[model samples]
Target chain A: MQQNNIAIKVNGLSKNFDISESGKGFSGKLKALFHRKRKIITAVDGIDFEIKRGEFVGYVGENGAGKSTTIKMLTGILVPTSGSAEVNGIIPFKERKKNAAKIGVVFGQRTQLWWDLPVRESFDLLRVIFRVSQSDFNSQMKKLDQVLDLNSLMSMPVRKLSLGQRMRCDIAASLVHNPPVLFLDEPTIGLDVLAKESIRNFLAEINREEGTTIILTTHDMNDIEHLCKRLIILEDGKIVYDGETELLKQKFVHEKVLEVEFHDDGNVIQGIPGVTVIREQGCKKWLTFDNDNYGIGEVIGTIASRYKIKDISVNEPSVESIIRNIYNNRVTLAMPSEKSPTK
Target chain B: MESIKIYIMLFTTSIKARMEYKVSFLFYIFAILSFYAGQFGLLFILLNRFHEIKGWSMGEMVFLYSLQAFAFGFTNLIFSQLVNFDKMIVDGEFDRVLVRPLSPLGQVIFSKFEVSTAAHLIIGFTALYFGSRYANIEWTFYKIILFPVIIMGGVMIAGGIRLMVTAVAFWTLRNRSLVHTVIFSSKEFINYPINIYNVGMQFFLTFIFPIAFINFYPAHFFLDRSGSGLLHPSLEMGTPIVGIIVITVSIFSWKAGVNHYQSTGS
Candidate 1:
């Protein structure tokens, strides 16, 4: 994609909060009321990246890692402390109204629909708020109905719907305006497997068919793995990793484990040229090696030639384990500089 | 114009929603009307015993009380959302407002449409008509024309105080009780004539928050009474202007408050 076609751009974007430190209990609260001890917290610490048009990017981080803060700033709901950001060529905070007309946002924990009003009434109200044309509104509703199964949900009050159903309606509500850019903050946080898959499929269809640039923040590993082609991982308010989802697994997940069992209990396995005999039991031996340097086929072939192997199995690392490794190790991986592709 | 239509649409839907609980809705109106009527009855009994207060008759007192109620009811009806704005901020709903194409203040103003407060208007107009029969003040073109304007001025002043008080929530994140005190306490003081209070309070009510100009000053000017002398008597004539200024300043404060806002977390 051309650089000029970037839909979302961030240049050293940051947000700092002045949090007040309070004491414990009612008396402590009174003391705090009299004398507030304030401290500054850097919620988003100067992160930078660009998302191309039609790109499905999963913005993932643990709780309090500034994922929601970044989405808020990009959508003009919160102003950054320093630096700048633009969505579709408009500075979000400075041109909030104009930017609002061009984007849609949905928070998983909240509902934009009026609680007491029926679902159809809420949609009709949004139609006026967005000033959507009559024909456009009908067409969009029909399209949403097909995927969201909104026909059965049109008359139910929002407060009456289950979590999965509400989330579907909320997603549909955000798209009533047909904004080119969409922000989904934990859109599938509390959904069931089938509900999650349905939302994921709908999001993919929207991105592919209408070319909507989607920025999804989610804690569901399945959501990130299934929906997003690109991934941005934030830790402690900093962008620690930004690359293709598959490339992250490939780069960090270097070693694979091999387990083998022998029929002869007396047989002992020795170290091979490229493999380490990490463990041994009565009839089983475990070996670990770099899959890139020594192929699993070669290691198995060597083991079979040397010992009478009864059974063999290879354990490939998953993306979940790779992320857990990154978190536990806290290794500052070398990030690709701007304008350079990681591949 | 489009914003006004949206406001009407929202108002209709809110009324419809409130009407869903039919028994509670009617009971609310009945209960509130009775409460205000009981309070008025107590005041009437006190006035009957005193016969007149500071040369002001019971009918004149009724005029003042009911006119203020009219203004209060209208302001409370139209700007009810401002009263609950602090709760909206704490609940993270304000961020949703910011994501919409509509102006936040406009949305807040029309977010709710209250029907119960209309009871105040029922009492107000009835009191005005009844008090006119007994007070026997000669009607003039000016008095007839300026009555509604002064009532509108009263509405603006009430709304302005609400806006200013609630705007403090942008920074403090909680101002419901403070707003309640500012609005209800002012209503309490304005129940009697401004001239009944001392100089300091009279000045505070007239110029500081300007609640007096909404009803008392305008009533004083129309009643042709020289109030217990604290300032130039002609200040009463400027209630309309004071109302406009109050609303304009409130809007500016509201704008500054919006800019000062840091939305709560999701």
Candidate 2:
């Protein structure tokens, strides 16, 4: 029996692409036309996960880590080579149109709206296409306007809007049908800090207040840090880590860094307890200590007593650094449900 | 019915997009109109010089050209975007279309329109009127009734040809060469009566590619020409049936292509 609470479920989902032989020059291309040698590339290896209703999950990976491929399978854009996937309890590839009505998708690099049409006209067309009633359309547009500040940009053609404005409209357009699930592939890519921040906030709000299940994939760690409650990291077409965002950080990163600047030059203080000096350059010093074994005050007091510290600051391992450590270390994180993770 | 409404909405939006550069658009329209008229003028000069080819008069030739032009133009207006199918697959437009609550074919159809085809449409209608006058063809009630139906059938045949070539792009990821040779240059076969060509070439055009259904075979009906010298007499009335079969097969091929699709990388 399929559960009503599950928004998305995937088991052994995979997609393989047949890439045609690419020859070098004119004659080579001509030869490839008739010879027809093909190589198969597995974009998404077998993966399993289930997302509950209203959960905000970040799908993160390196450039070719199958993040976008997984999202494409869920959206019914590409049929998987093997395994099964269900969105809102409907098989997406089999009943694509049915699945489409229940979900909304936005590709950050591509605009779903008509490029040359006015923003309002595009939304209105989408409303009719998605079978959104007039009252519901009105309410959705009103809410989108408040959240995305879309009123000023409605009259302009989509091509005329700046990248930031177009991205905002794309997000607003995705929600016009008020779909219960939204899939975003690299939605924050190539945006400035402020633009990404607004998109991040809007996504977080929509996921929380409207109870919409969102799966976002991005290279920006800040997007994952601020918007996602859960993180699922992919490495070379396989899931490497899947758990709460906080939990992944805690499991992978434990040591914290503290930096101190001494008033006197060339001061590399030694013999500090509970904290080991990791780096020394000029009058500045960096120390590392396990957060679990020593308190922040205890580490700081040990350093200050032995040396005259002019300025001091403590650093917790940021989500970016922690994720970098995971990717670099090639950590094979155990699935939390299968077993408790051990170092 | 709702699909029709959405198509109209998208159609008008397309017109607005073309209206963005009014001066350049008008210039393009003018260029196309004159270019077609000039081609007809050259044909007139050549026919005046040769008098007739295979006993077919200049008027009959012009009429054949006009019918083919109108059918080809209507198909071009509707299905020219199929030529860009590779771009859609590579540039994420197909991905966007698949995720929407609409038929993928319908979405692709409504996404873009070749509005400049109005030039071919206008030239086709006017030349057709004058060519019929020159040919002294009598328009009986049945002939008049069948004229619009024949034209629509002709459009379907040409559209199906374009669609089949486009379907090849799904696996190939590019169809520029096919679009040029099959959808474009192939239409030149019906510019004259098929009987003008040799038996082998005529068989290829009539049975193999079947571009003759687009104009030549059907033109015999309106011209009051007998099928005595043709391959088969019944072929003159083959437009509507040939059209239905070709489009159905092409659509099936297109659907299969979609099923076999592998979208480009992100």
Candidate 3:
């Protein structure tokens, strides 16, 4: 029943919670004793997807978007209300202990290390918990040290370490057991740019070198841009988009700003087929165009051939704004053209 | 067997962590021992002033108090996490336990081993040492052999109560007040002989919660006194069985509570 290439298979997985609806004040409380109100909230709607082995996929959603709930079900921290999921050919909730041995999880908000003990002691304890052989534990530590630079940090108590330092140690702690699959929930959240870059690079290297399957959920667009080649975007407890990470940027983030400064004020250029003048002050005009439909160079060539010589520059819209736009619009990006980017 | 080894390892780590704060640990032991001593002094004064209650002397009352204290202390030392399960649930540590490659119940129970409560044993045995002399209890083979079994059974009963209280947290995530009320009320009721209470109250403690079997009814059987005929004194033979039954029911409730558990906010 186990498939070799499928690292994860999620079929119509869902989770629902029953929350009590209680009234405020003493009279309301007394009156409600006879009739208790309750409401059911579907945190994770029926969603389906499969991840292949050695795939580094980014799962992105806003707060209260059911990202954490889905991870909890996959990690066996919470049982699903309906449907089913398998990680590495094992039903995670049914065979939690066995599945736990094959997966590594890192929660950015909390460290897995023992609070009062030194970092080395925490790893030693985990070695016993996971039953890692002594040689394997040493080799794993060596490998983690290469990327994480954990040698200097191993002696310090976890509570005394800085957040970034503790995060690095936490990531290393999760990998000591050499689990085949890793789940990271906001792994780079609340870290400085430098720290975030290092973590991203380390994750990329692990995925490339070790062939470990990683499922990451993060709100940071930079993390998705740098590390994730594929993405699954969730909204309102359902998958809104699932495709190559670059496709999202190309389709939704294709708008580029072209600012043209003409040599003479008399020369007023008319619009091209795909270019629209968004702002004009004096001889300078800022035109916006979809790069996917019409090449930036083609539009600039048409303007230059018609008018006097001018200086021009193009600016691609930041990925942050494009993602924000998509989230606000709640529309899947429909590629209007099949042509690739033209210089 | 592997789980037992891991439990010891976890307990050792807990002890090492507590040892990091040596002064506080020692002070806690001293404070608890002194607190028990103060309670003993207060009860000594009460029994001396009243002379006797229901034909039971001060020594018999001391024996009852000390026996329950020892059992409660032993259970509290090993299984205190069950009493404090609300905090773990509220802080989201229970989720961490589930992700580990071990039984959640084993990890939670053994995660917190309170070496500080060793003072309870010292106080209990000290009380017994002094109380047995005053009560003029005869040393015999049967009495000596059964003493350990009775103490262990009483401990299981205390642990069972703690487990039952912890199970309530699955529905009410932070029921600190409710848990403390149940634990403290039952502890208060067990310090005195069941004969002092009325018949209905006796039945309530015996059948409803079975707090009476922890020490009171056993004391009646050991002291060679005929109970009020409501329940037979020979029922003391089933103290171990009562402890076993109570623990089994508590475990079932705990499992059901775990199944019903919905983890808190992310």
Candidate 4:
């Protein structure tokens, strides 16, 4: 949202994985030791983006689209093969400990907290690791307790908690250091509806109140819709789109759907300008029209004059559809340079 | 200082978790004791049948056996994770250790402490005491003090070797067979006196892997046996220093291995 105050900046970062051509097993391992055949797969191709302080950005991509790889590079868990990335003004891979100290990362598929220890003990251990002062630790814990409702779960062993409960505790554990940047990889994955809602709300509140810059990667479209204003779409190890979330939907979705109910059983609107009948069943008609070419009012007016319309409703394309369109390479959203205002 | 506190906390928590299965924990202790007892019984039977082997008295053999046992027990107790290194790497558990602020080696070494191995230590000490009495060696203060130093050196050498083997797993990804070869071969060398082997074999064992530094060389020096004339006077007097060198090299290798760690798929 702001320039030159970037909390995270990436410049042409990429990673390549060497997969043994012989495949995975004892034979492959032996083959890899000597006279090996290997294939180089690029997990993250060169791509760049910048996120300002206090921005919530959703990094969305399909499976094997390098979302996790990009996150790992950002978090300093994996080194980039080429190019560079900085979080909070420090190069991540070069100054990993410093970067780690300034950021919190949570992978929903895995828990970083000690399994046998109680949630509170795990939090305390994290505090010790991060070297948080006592008063700051307590205040942060209090904030986490209020936001995540962690009191009941704190005393329970982490291994004994349900997935949702563990996830809430994990978020709390990650935040104990009061890290300015937070990386959440599929934080709402495998969560129930209510659990997802609570996590989403807590994340929003923290980003707003604490000004915590967040980079969230999730396959779930709902998380993006609910939490992030900015979205970056990755496909085949490259960024296909990066812009405001609403702009993506507007740019990609060409047609809008209109549902009409006829007052008379036999009444029908055969055709309208820039509109195609999607389906008709039992006096209800679903029509699709190019939003860029025709306004909903003009379409509705034409439909009403042609047929006895009793009720009508219009639906814009959903975020899921827009993402799917990106994944299928059906639409191209404008890049930042292309969207810069003309002189 | 903070890392030490965290390590202690981790150690205590792991012990508590292990104790949660009280029956299994007790059974594990019993099993280890019985295994060591069985080996001791065989040693007793051998000593009863034969007066000595290679000009070495049964009591001296006991000293050698005890030294090896103590060294192996202490190494296994503190670094048992090394024995299971392949499983941790394959399961991606090493990723967890990497994320922690503390050294990954420290976390792994302290992750699990085998309390059951204490039984081996007790049995080894008992055998050493009885053997000393039977050997009827003069109770000089220097000889007495040298015993603990020898045992500590033995532990350090064993730990160093184990750490090196575990470190190899970083590159190899699987080292069970390699570990088995190294451990069993070293055990074969340590089970008997180093003097029994030819000079070249002695040099190989002493200079290369240094399994002899753990028990044979130290035991020979303590008993005033065959190795006294062969080794350099300073090296003979500084066997513990050799152990320390081995340990330092092993740690350096481990650090290098960690630097080369290419973490598995994200």
How do the residues B1-266 of candidate 1 rate in per-residue lDDT, one tens digit apiece?
98889878877887877777799889978887788788668556644765577677777877777778789989988888888899989999899888988788888888786666767677787777756666666679999898889989899999998899999998789998999899777798887777777889888987897898777877776677775535577777777789899999999998888766777764
For residue A20, what is the lDDT in candidate 2?
A: 80
What is the per-candidate TM-score for chain B? 0.92, 0.92, 0.91, 0.91
Model 2 has an lDDT value of 0.85
Q: Could you say which candidate leads in TM-score?
A: 2
What would the per-residue lDDT of candidate 3 be over residues A113-135, giving only the tens digit for each residue?
A: 88988898889988988889899
Q: Write the per-residue lDDT of candidate 2 for residues A280-310, one digit (tens) a residue.
A: 8888888898776677888888777877889
The alpha-carbon lDDT assigned to residue A282 of candidate 2 equals 83
Compute the lDDT of residue A122 as modeled in candidate 3. 89
Q: What is model 2's C-alpha RMSD?
A: 2.9
Output the better candidate (1/4) by TM-score: 1
Q: lDDT of each model, Cα atoms only?
A: 0.85, 0.85, 0.83, 0.81
Question: Which tens-of-lDDT digit does each residue in B1-266 have in candidate 2?
Answer: 98889877777777777777789889978887787778667556644765577878888877888888889889989997787878888776799899988889887887778876887787688668866987878999999899888888988889988898898989888778878888878877777678878888887887777888877887788998877334576778898888898899999999988888887777
Better of 2 and 3 by lDDT: 2
**What are the per-residue Cα lDDT tens digits for candidate 3 across B1-266?**
87788777887887777777899889977887788677667556644765566787778777777778788889878788777888888888787887889888889888887664676787687778766777877767898899888888888888888888889999889888887888766788877677788888888888887888888877776676676424776787667888898888899998878777788786
Score residue B153 of candidate 1 by CA lDDT.
89
